[model samples]
Target: MTNVASPVAVVTTMDGRRPYGTTVSAFASLSLAPPMVLVSLDDRSQQLAIIRRTGRFGLNILSTRQAALAAAFARSGPDKFEGVAWSPSEGLPRLPDSAAWIAAEVDDYISAGDHTILLAQAVTAESAEGSPGPLTYHQRSFGTHTPLAP
Candidate 1:
């Protein structure tokens, strides 16, 4: 996995009126026909519990400019959103400037070793104006990608 850079995104879940978010590089598309996606989280993650309870989540695909935001959510603590700019998207908090935002409902979950794999089906999706490269996580660092010449 270190050889290939994975796109980074901030996954948000709400517990009642309070919101929670974390940086996730293990997010990927599961199916394109039904618009399904998957996100892997530590089994002990608080956001996992909240997502299980609410059966809902928001995936904000971070742009290269949001690297600092990615680092903020990567830490384990309560004040992750300290001064992050965000607003609600269909009741789930979302980063307004993300390259893409997806609102989804939990379809299924499976326990795989130390992580819980969440399979979600998209309910609504949106993307920012103008195409931009995504923020990526690889080799324990954050970076951006450039297109390869054909």
Candidate 2:
């Protein structure tokens, strides 16, 4: 799917008193009537295990300037948030300066191939004012979206 361009995001959850997260590109709006989202995670992802245990998570849609942050969380480790600035929102870790944020409760988990698809209901949603364009991944490189002339 390297040819497919996708928005970058970080899926965060609290593991006891510690915060954990992973970078993902497979997130999408699943529904509107009931405010829902779908996030796909590798079956072996530690973050997925946390979400299963807690039944909740926060999605931080990264901004154009957050490519480094995305790379940081994408690494396999527990220190992804070591120096990252964030706060608790609805009891979940919320990254600062993201393009958008969504806190959701897991409604179901669907197993597909090597990944688990989380069907979640959004409990809280927010968009930053004048945030930079969304961060994107395409062809194994980080980038951002640009509007075409009308």
Best by lDDT: 2
Clashes of each: 0, 0
Q: How many residue-pair clashes does candidate 1 contain?
A: 0
TM-score to native of every candidate shown = 0.95, 0.98
Residues 55-144, candidate 1: write the lDDT tens digits: 999999999889989999999997787787789888898996788999999999999999999999998888889847789888888888
Candidate 2: tens digits of C-alpha lDDT, residues 1-150? 999999999999999999999999999999998999999999998899999999999999999999999999999988999999999999999999999999999999999999999999999999999998799999999999999999
Candidate 1, 14: how far from true, in Å? 1.2
lDDT of 2: 0.96
Looking at model 1, residue 114 earns an lDDT score of 99
TM-score, structure 1 vs. true: 0.95
Candidate 1 residue spans exceeding 4 A from truth: none
Clashes (candidate 2) = 0
